[model samples]
Target chain A: MARARSEERRAEIVRAALEVIAERGYRGASLGAVAERVGLTQQGLLHYFPTKEALLVAVLEERDRWDTSGGRDRERWRLDLMESLVEYNAMRPGIVQTFSALLGESVTEDHPARAFFTERYTQVRENMAEVLRAEFGDELPGGLTPERVAPLLTAVMDGLQYQWLLDPDAVDMGASFRDFLALLREDSKRSA
Target chain B: MARARSEERRAEIVRAALEVIAERGYRGASLGAVAERVGLTQQGLLHYFPTKEALLVAVLEERDRWDTSGGRDRERWRLDLMESLVEYNAMRPGIVQTFSALLGESVTEDHPARAFFTERYTQVRENMAEVLRAEFGDELPGGLTPERVAPLLTAVMDGLQYQWLLDPDAVDMGASFRDFLALLREDSKRSA
Candidate 1:
């Protein structure tokens, strides 16, 4: 029971960090702000996370958990399921804002989150390749292998997020993704 | 002669800020660092750009100018010219990193660069629509209008930048952009 309570508190802290990050961005967010939101002193917060980077990692991991939940399998993801995920993201602006901010910063060579995003993209691209191969055999309709197009798939997903975050009213992220998917489907049809 | 020298100094300062931002990201970059690189005091740098935000805006504008130079017209961007631009970007990792960093932070509601990116994208999308219409007529093979597909074009370009930044060796940004263009060409063929 004590361990369960500790885990619960940790999760609460991660959520608070997400809120602070969404409002102020990762650069502007402070541990004190997150601590105050969760009613903990900075020292007490350190007992749980040990560092801001650790808290950021926790937040990213938790976000992945939310994304892959509901019977979704990352390795076996289909386009339709991915569309649903985009739709789900559209409902959560705060989480998306925090994620976009961190992803942008993570591109810097020395950013603490650099390795995390790099590794994530590597895995994400591989998983995308597997999904593509499962749907379309050795080659896509465009004559490019799944490996060749995986990065583009990941790029489109992320690019849509950036545009949507900047102008939620103007960008329909889910619809835009579906259109890309349609293009893929059309290519497949041509090759078939 | 004095006015010309002042303009030259301003351009020099913008270049310095770009380097600083590329090295440390926008949040970590300081006016003092940029000033030191250009052999100016912080106060001297402020004379050209009244604030850090102004400097950032100038950098962004300079980047756009470089992107659209050489008789290239924004209102009439061809896919081939876009390909050349991507190739040009591949040659300048530093400038790309600074732009990506600012673009990411600009997603925040209160960021100083937010308005600049928002306005820039709005114009970019319109320009992309014109590019598409010039190539394809009123509708694409996918049955979407140029206006509908413009955002995806911009998204793909920006998305490719993020992935390429993370792993330049793995991602051939120019080649991938060309592949997307091929898809567009193929789509047009089928509809024709």
Candidate 2:
């Protein structure tokens, strides 16, 4: 029961952090506000994560944790990635916004999420490209390296989120992504 | 000569505003600091753009104007677009960062730049697709639409900018964009 309660508190802190950071941005968000959101004292919140940066890292991890558990079926990764994107955009527009603000600042060689984002982008792109390679076989053109295409895929996802965050109707992640995939396939043939 | 001096002052104010906003964000940047940067009184700064919003709008418009005139040759639009992107990522990183922050807030139904961004995205997408259509002949397999393709182009450009801003070396915009163009050509070939 103690361990379970601790887990609950951690989750609570992460949720509160997301709400606070979303509203206040990375620079403005404070432990006091997050604690207040959770009905805990600042000191109490510190028990879970000693520093604000830790809490931020935790919050991002929690978001990705939920994303990781989702889309279990490898066969439908494309569809699943698209669906997860829509759900993520709906559930936490602020997180996306905060990310857009912090993205440049966070890319330093020492930034906490640098490794995570780099690896995450790599893995997701390889997965998507492999699916394409398998579907089309050798006829699938030559130079379509996963490294080459992954950035485009990742960029579309990130860019579409920005657009959707602005005018939800102006950007359609799933449709746009599917169209890109189709276009990618077509482009592969043209170069063949 | 008086009008030329006034235009120069306006440019100075805009430059000062961009630096202040980059350091302090849209909210933290104040008229006083901007005025000080430009060696003008607050009233003088206000003479050009009366409100913060007006100043921001002017900054965004200036960015648009810069984009329109800077290295954007019409003959080889694709190469021009690619080189322009590389130059932008190198020279005006602050503009990209500020634009990301403002983009979220500006997309409301009635923000001053709402129509501007909306039309800008639409027009840019169409223009890009026309270039692709011209290169690939109007019909391509998978029944791809230019409307669909254009947004993807913008998404990749916008998204890649965010990533590159974070980690300058994460993806090479010129190389990746060039690769995308190659992919587009390959995809145009069909199974034959």
Candidate 3:
């Protein structure tokens, strides 16, 4: 019960932090506003997160966790990954906005999310490459390695999201994603 | 003389504002810091920009002007554009970071920069498309219209810059750009 309760509170704080960050932005967002959103005192909020930066880091980590959850079979992994990206962009637009803003501000060597994003991207690349390697293992197309293609895939998804956020009606993301997949196929064929 | 002096002062304020925003973030960035940077009083700084939001908008506009001017010619446009990107990233990494963070924050309809970004993007797309169309004239590639391709190209560049900033050594931007051009060439040939 205690562990579950703590988990629930942490989740609550994370959600509240997102809302606050979304509403007030990273810099204007305050511990007081976060506490007020959750009906907690400032002290109570700090009990879970010692600083505003810590709270921001937690919010990013939570997002990274939700994003990095790998639950698809190897055969359908690529589709599953792309679909998750589409779904995540649709569902968590606020987090996307907040994170884009954070990426700009958090450039210091020690910024909490700096390592997380770095490691997260690396892990995402490795994991994605693993899935692709598995899918194409013996039948791998072209000489394209997962490592080379993975970052580009990540960049395209991220790039598409930024565009979508700016003008949703402008781009057909589904078509673009399909085009990207087709390119991968072409690359694979060339290598083969 | 008065008008010229005012213009120079405004330019100074915008420059200082970018520096301040880069250092303290958009929300944390204050007029006082901007004023201090320009060796003026906060009241004097307010004389130009009026508010923090205005200052941010002005900084962005200034950056756009600074970045785009005398930077590209019809021939070697691709290389010139890439060099501009690399130069911008190297020279004002912080301001770029701040601007991106601001872009994420300003998406809301009422956010001060929302309309600015929206209008800016529209103009950029149109202008870039026009340039490309003019350059290619009667021989424009396949069904790949400039309207369809310009936005994607811009997004790729922006996304690449973000990745580069996160891990400068990790992303070989120049090579990736060359690869993008090569892909475009292949697509054109296949279409032809």
DockQ comparisons of all candidates to the true complex: 0.55, 0.28, 0.25
Over A109-142, each residue of candidate 3 has an lDDT whose tens digit, in order, gives 3566677667666676777677766656633223
Worst 10 residues of 1 chain A by lDDT: A67-76
- Error at B115, model 3, angstroms: 2.1
Q: Backbone clashes in each candidate structure, one number apiece?
A: 0, 9, 6
lDDT for position A192 in model 1: 64
Q: How close is candidate 3 to the true structure, as a TM-score?
A: 0.76
lDDT for each residue of candidate 2 in B82-118, tens digit (9 for 90 to 100): 5566665566565665665456445333556566567
- Model 3 chain B scores worst on lDDT over the 10 consecutive residues at B135-144
Chain B, candidate 2: TM-score: 0.72
Instruction: Please state the CAPRI-style docking class of candidate 2.
Output: acceptable
lDDT of 2 by residue, A1-192 (tens): 999999999988898888787676655568999999999899998999887767877777777666656546556555445556666566666677555544533443355655655665556666656655555554433356655676777788777766665556766766777777676566445446
State the fraction of real interface contacts model 2 keeps.
Answer: 0.40
lDDT of each: 0.81, 0.67, 0.66
Model 3: per-residue Cα lDDT at residue A86: 68
User: For candidate 3, lDDT tens digit of each residue in B123-155?
Assistant: 777766766665444333233566665665566
lDDT per residue for candidate 1 within B49-109, as digits (tens), equals: 8878778889989888777765264553787888999998888777787778778888876
